[model samples]
Target: MKLAFDRGRRTRAATWVSLGLTFAVALVVELTFADSSKADSPLDSKGDQGNSQVERGRYLARAGNCVSCHTSPGGPAFAGGLALNTPFGKLYSTNITPDPETGIGKWTEEQFARAVREGVRPDGAHLYPAFPYTAYTKLSDEDVSALFAYMKVVKPVSFTPPENEMGFPANQRWALGMWKMLFFDEGRFLADSSQSEEWNRGAYLVEGLGHCSACHSPRNFMGAEQASMAMTGGEYTDKVPSGEIRTWSAPNLTDVPNGLGSWPMEEVAAYLRTGRNGFTETHGPMNEVILNSTRHLSEGDVRAMAVYLKSLPGNVGNIGKAASAQVIEDGETLYNVNCGTCHQPTGLGALSEQAGAKLVGNPLVQASNPASLINVILYGPHLAKLPGPKRWKDMPEFGSKLSDDEVAAIASYVRSAWGNVGGAVTQEQVAKQR
Candidate 1:
């Protein structure tokens, strides 16, 4: 009986030993596969390959103009607190630094990608469309991974942005899911087989990361971009250095008289690179874009964007109407007194000191919306001092000097004179700009 009991105990011990061995082998196999998967992941492997991936990501970030929205004035880079004023309400940008508590430090690559492409948070909350995730959703996985890798290494800042000041339905984040269902098309860019490689690359950059249409295309009442008017021009409100909210027009990008049709591809590329071409200089929000984004891009990329912009079909849909002969004559007189010295009497513009942009064929002058022209007249050009010969002289602000009627008249004169196709500017429009 004693021998039988001992044998039973040994048999049970053997079974226990067998179970332990099986568990150990299974753990080893699981760990091996896990390590292999990590190594295989582009996010992990490319991130491990030093600064190359990070640098690429940085370039992509610039291309996306991330810093402009993420960083507020006088704030640390990428440490978000910028106030973005939408029609609904004011929304503050969130910190994107690597801070674990306030920023995206704890987010995984998958979470980051999902946030960017799907516009959903790690906690499954929907992001507002103001974040431009609708356009970002077209980002390729590789680019998304690169961006994540770059963000992971950014100097973590322990800062929390102010909460969004949205009212009613706009404040409700859940409604974004329905918004996405209606307007957001979540997918990657598919290169056109018929287009050239450069064209395809341009299309990808312009339509995807650039998100040009977000500003250049008018939005519906629901804040979704109007598909019918893709890039014919749109209006946005900008808060200038002085705590004043100003409305500016993003001009047409389509190949039309009011758009980039008159601009040579090289001129467009040059303008993007240096913020000034032979015709006009970058002002307002475009200053920020050039200073923070396009100036940092590679020549090839800038040229690609120009190519894409130049290729867009023209759609000049009732942008402006003709001014009266008396209004044009009065405007001409104002232009001669106020603007003609810099911009020649013929509107060819002088290249000498105090140079004015050629008003005759200028796209801004011919733009459908005269808000920008009016704003320029009101506030003067808030031009960025880019690296190049300072061809444009500082025009003193006429806001305190010129009446709304006078500003409107001057704008009307330029838009109608020299065969400029831009519509007339009203005193009411000028008053609103003020």
Candidate 2:
């Protein structure tokens, strides 16, 4: 996530001119064939004055987790200025507050709907996929109108975000049209007739506003999500409080031995609601998602999401290899000396005391990627303080104490022992995380 603009600009001017002409034609083609239908009628006629519609919109915004990306640290909510670092470039989120000059105050409902569903700005500029409009495009018309209504009423803030620092070709906004043609599919969520009403509701939320796949699914060279491998896990970087960029793995959501196959529906619901199940607790980015989004959802909606997630078929094709026996043995020795007091020799964990999480049958320990497992061993879990009586102390950081080989040994041991099937950790992987 280095700033592309900081790189030396030595390219010939002809290269820019050639790319500009190509993109201009692509933009014209995209706009020519784009759907021109007007937005549907509002769900309610009372406009923003309708308390019920506004309230529903407020809840939907929570489901969308809008503020998490829109607001900068210590800044007004929705007065966006968050820097989103991606492989292609850095993009700053735009202010969504109702400020006429700097936010969405002057945007009409049709303009808002088009932006959310079509990835097109009011002035006809193509928005980068980093906005997750690909998933938002699946939102129902009613939900779109409700969201617009809610946004219209938020307090206005007159802050403008910093300009995006994308590299030469990516800095070309019109190039996004060609990217869309290759991967984007604009449409609303279609309910399955064979599925239960609760299941359908869950699918709508997860596929549309929740935008779960945007994080959970792996992306290709062009940064589009791989449709065939949806939710088998993905990796992304987040800026830690220490200002260092850290890579994190989003575990597979499918029903598999290494994923959620072993998790009960109730456990999934509990985790979403409270950020912890009896077996494991959330840390890092997931903590923010639960705190800002899922925890605020209704009980029925939570259960529905759990049901849908549990129904996903496991991807058996991508299972990892077991760690070497010698590595596991060394790891076990380290675990006994440093971890057994809290985790116990059996790996059952002391949930009542909250000293450690259950490693046996833990989805994270058995994830396809071992990045998060290694991260925890190196940095300790930066577990957020929730509203409850304190039962255990925070896990200490081992980064300063453990050698790269020793850390890899411990990670390899947990990932392969106790019937876990995740891949072994290499000293090289440990060094990268450090």
Candidate 3:
């Protein structure tokens, strides 16, 4: 009886000690992050206000793809109203324009910096990860200041975004502080001394302002990107402005067979700059990326990005087998009859923007999955409406005209033919994407 009592007492004491330790840790973290609110800006004393600062900010803003998320279609630039669909609920972007009433105009420089890097609002509320502050946290003070300068100079429109539609506990903004405690690592870009300046620059742009991993890397149920599989590609589904549901497979960016390994740096740079290379064309979300962000960048920056991407460690994923002899034969027949005139008998379509787009050795064609290929075949590009040079002509949707088998056959043929070696796609795969 005495021993049992002593054991029970020990257990209770241990429990109390654990609770105390947890509270102490929580207090330390809260104090650490809250200190960001009072953080000083090195640029505070510079007093560097001029067109050059604004212009530098403009470049940084473009690199960050600020307008794409912050602005709605037909709305004034940066007057945020875009609805971002997440597992929790639809979250609308807040206006970052300089309007005193509706936007960040009232925010002090310190307030803005804290929001950008620490994901904390001026009111001490936590922001959702949908804002991509996880990646933005790596931004340097200079770039952050430049971004602020540019935003302040933009024409501020008087409009407030609608409230986010988060369900239940997710709506509790305080909980996001816990989420940050678990995942957020507040820091600036640390250049690898071993790499060249260009490589480091590219790494900074891709990992920080570009936030490429947000879409390319697979995410957990909670939506935090998997660090282990960074830039290896993943699945993304979204509802378009037209209310059509669309899904895309962001291809791997590594230098593996499943990625951009075969493509030259020039091809990569061209694709970024113009939305089209000789090999493949950008459509869907990538089109918006090029139109709004990469296309506006200088040639040197674009080249540097390509250099960095091509240097990532390769990660080869589950690759399917080549189509059977019978499947290829049927696909060849269908291709000749339905797809040949445009894509050509050789599978190398014309280079002219008005003509058919190149398909042979196209990276999208060679992706591990056939979702993107099937999507374009069924829906014909589902192109985003944005201002840019029209680099590729939109193709007609053959979803209704061609049966699933025929579509699969043609896709298989494209994957296997013209020096392309991507594995054959299945009918079930085609049906699901459809």
Expressed as tens digits, the lDDT of each residue in 267-371 for candidate 1 is 999988888888888776677677767888899989999998899988885565788888999999999999988888999886666767778678777776788
Candidate 3 wrongly placed segments (more than 4 Å) = 1-50, 239-243, 320-329, 352-355, 382-394, 416-429
Give each model's whole-structure lDDT: 0.75, 0.76, 0.73
Better-scoring candidate (TM-score), 1 or 3: 1
- Residue 213 deviation, candidate 1, in Å? 0.9
- The alpha-carbon deviation from the true structure for residue 173 of candidate 2, after best TM-score superposition, in angstroms, is 1.3
lDDT of each residue in 309-367, candidate 2, tens digit only? 99998874255666788999999999999888888788888766656778887877766
Candidate 1: regions farther than 4 A off: 1-49, 240-243
Name the regions of candidate 2 deviating beyond 4 angstroms: 1-50, 390-393
**What's the TM-score of every candidate structure?**
0.87, 0.87, 0.81
